[model samples]
Target: MENTIFSLIPPFLAIIMVVLTRRVLLSLGVGIVSASLLLANFSLTGTVSIIYDAVKGIFVSEGSLNTSNIYILLFLIILGIITSFITISGGSRAFGEWAITRVKSRVGAQIVTIFLGIIIFIDDYFNALAVGQISRPITDRQKVSRAKLAYLIDSTSAPICVVSPVSSWGASIIALIGTILATHNITEYSAFSAFIQIVPMNLYVWATLAMVFIVALRNIEIGPMKIHERRAVKEGLVSDPNKPAVDKLQEDLPTSKKGSVGDLVWPIIALIVGVVGTMFWTGIVGSEGNVSLLAVFENTDVNTSLIIGGLLGLAVTIGFFIRQVLVYKSVDKSVFKKGVWAGTKSMLPAVYILLFAWTIADLIGRLETGKYLAGVVEIINLNHSFLPLILFVIACVMAFSTGTSWGSFGILLPIAGDIAAATDISLLLPALAAVLAGAVFGDHCSPISDTTILSATGAGCNLIDHVMTQLPYAVISALIACFGFLVIGFTGSTTLALLTIVVLLILFVIITSRRTKEV
Candidate 1:
């Protein structure tokens, strides 16, 4: 009993610290330290040994910087470099300028912004920054609140990427599913197969997308976000208090080189082509020449594909530089360095977050906390007929605590997958869907979530401000998803269940819009 209680201490403390401090790194550090202290308390060697071991385990253990985490971090850095290059070369600005010319109304601008976010569907981190940067000017020009812009960016980032077949998120989910399948002795099951099976069942992903469209089209305003939206309409985009006034001056100054639609369109095309080509070559061509696309995804790993895509992005950047230099009859070294610096700097925060998340996961695993937690979950009634709802809540809680959808999925997939297999449940679809939905729920709501922070940063909104404003909508969506899962679990009709939620959510948004108008 005492040991069980001690085991729960770290996670509880971690949650409290995050809620109190709202600093992810600090919260993670506190969680790790608390876990170490608890482990020491349980062990004969006491607190010092536990602390030393935890620190040493991170640096010295092979498990600490394993292949998957290393690959993810490397990909993040590469993506950062690529994005930075694009931004420095004025691609993002060009896109924004082009969007402003094309979009006629504030509503149209918001819809287009959300549409572009949906189309990107590559990486959430990339989506968050890229969409925010590209659309910020357009949203600003239209008098849309920065908070609303951040919400749009945040809404699309994880939700769309998680559901897309040709993205980093797709790759991670597939890999996790594959791990689950292999662990459960299901050799016939594949990641892509599992992904397709679960995609329809991913209530939160579909519902969130539905909510985005409904909110945009109906112009629904609720909670703290409603207040911010009204305020921004009255006063204009709020400047960041932390940034220097000089930065504001630079942003306000007029530009000599205005970007055209072609400048924006071609690069985006090139990026999409590169990503698709790489995935096709690696997933389709490399396998049996005639396998289905879904089969290929199940069989192939997307990390390698993304690396290829990054190289392709580099090539495209080089081509753009050449074209510019030749067209102008001049070359500037400063421009090249500027692109590199921008990409590197933009990616630094993600890199740091990844490293810290990895270290914390490793530390927790070493202390056997995750395993023990897994056992405790199994020991409970989490595997019953209503297991789907249990899994949903568990996933949401884990993800909320961890501040990462990916990490939450990583932790819960195996446990949920195994339980699903043992119970003769069609575990592949619902289990995977539950984890995915839960991760998004947590990612959406957690104040410390990296994507949430990135959304705020990209939109130039306050971090806490974004969190407070966004929470109510996220809660509503999560509750709806939870109810949807319950219906699916009982009736085994995922499509109907999701459709019902969609209709209900749409109605809710329309009604809310009317209510706001009346108020």
Candidate 2:
């Protein structure tokens, strides 16, 4: 099972169960047990040990605490608390009212979310959570579904970061490219330059971004997203009432009549400033000497920065809570404890889901699911012209199965480099670009993906609803990207491939808008 077809069973089982049951934790739990069983060869004690070690590993790795995972979980709680106070201070309500007057239309609300998502391209995690906080109130006021908002956040977060050279994703990829270039004895182009060149080659990013804007502007809700839009438009329910959401705890919280938009805007500003400041600080501190922008991003501790930012945001929110109760006298002092608890409680679901996801992802890694998939790709003798397309599909499967785009990058990028170097060195960048695109595509579709979970959490959407609704759009963009990769593989023309993708995307938007009911 470690490096064979059997390794694929656990993740697929979990994913299929999630689609069928619409229960994220249960599905992930089942997947975890299944993976442990497979890894233990059906032995009860071995299975238990494997499960224990995997769960334990989430917090402790190699005798030290897994600060990254722990910090991320803490940040979510802090974000939740901040959200609670923001709502209690009437910031959310006030912002919604203000946005209603200014935005005026559903399309405008969606566009604002997309724009924010694109602008905050430093890290996908920050973009997903922060943009959701800023855009959710506006989208809610405009009757936009949480699922659609999640789609916008998810699509924008990774797709934008993957292409931006100054982003954490770009930094990691450049570092990997540097190592791969060195290993293959290829030095014609520096890693940074190669990364810049491949930016245009990541067709999925452009396709997904185009699809997001087109869907927003044209009011095209494809597949299950249509149902969500219909519900939001007709019934005024942004989220599914029957499902559990990350923001559900704030539903009944008291709000102040005296609250102003500054209550919301100021804390978010602090969060952004704190996080970016910390990112720079960490990156500079971690670097050996003479640092550049890319070095800062590459060396920055994202989870630590997030927690520090979350703390700053939380403090600012608490100050607002105090002002509402003390200065304005609009909110009751008695609501303080209740509001804090509710806010903290709201993020518990996201935390539990992340914990389970991390556990299952660990087990899947132990099974070598991605390695097996890569091995299968390596054995297949195909024409060099098809290598880019083949790598794209394989990378998609690997990232989807493993539920981590970074993990896919670590596993498949070197393999892609080696294969391209052996067959046709000229195809190296194209092949690498395919892997990057495929990994993001796969990450978008995976239920266990942290970015997917964070997007849904940030939007206050049901996890399953987010996953199901975004599937068709992700698939559409991926299909377009696949065609682009096919074109790139054969013709080696990034320009022609991009042109084909843009043309197909426009046709898709036109056809879908004509057929679908407008929200």
Top TM-score hit: 2
Q: Which candidate is the best by lDDT?
A: 2
User: What is the Cα-based TM-score of model 1?
Assistant: 0.76
lDDT of each: 0.67, 0.93
Query: Any idea how many clashes model 2 has?
Result: 0
lDDT of 1 by residue, 38-96 (tens): 65655646655766665555445655544444554555555555545444445557766
Whole-model lDDT, model 2: 0.93
Which residue pairs show backbone clashes in model 2? none
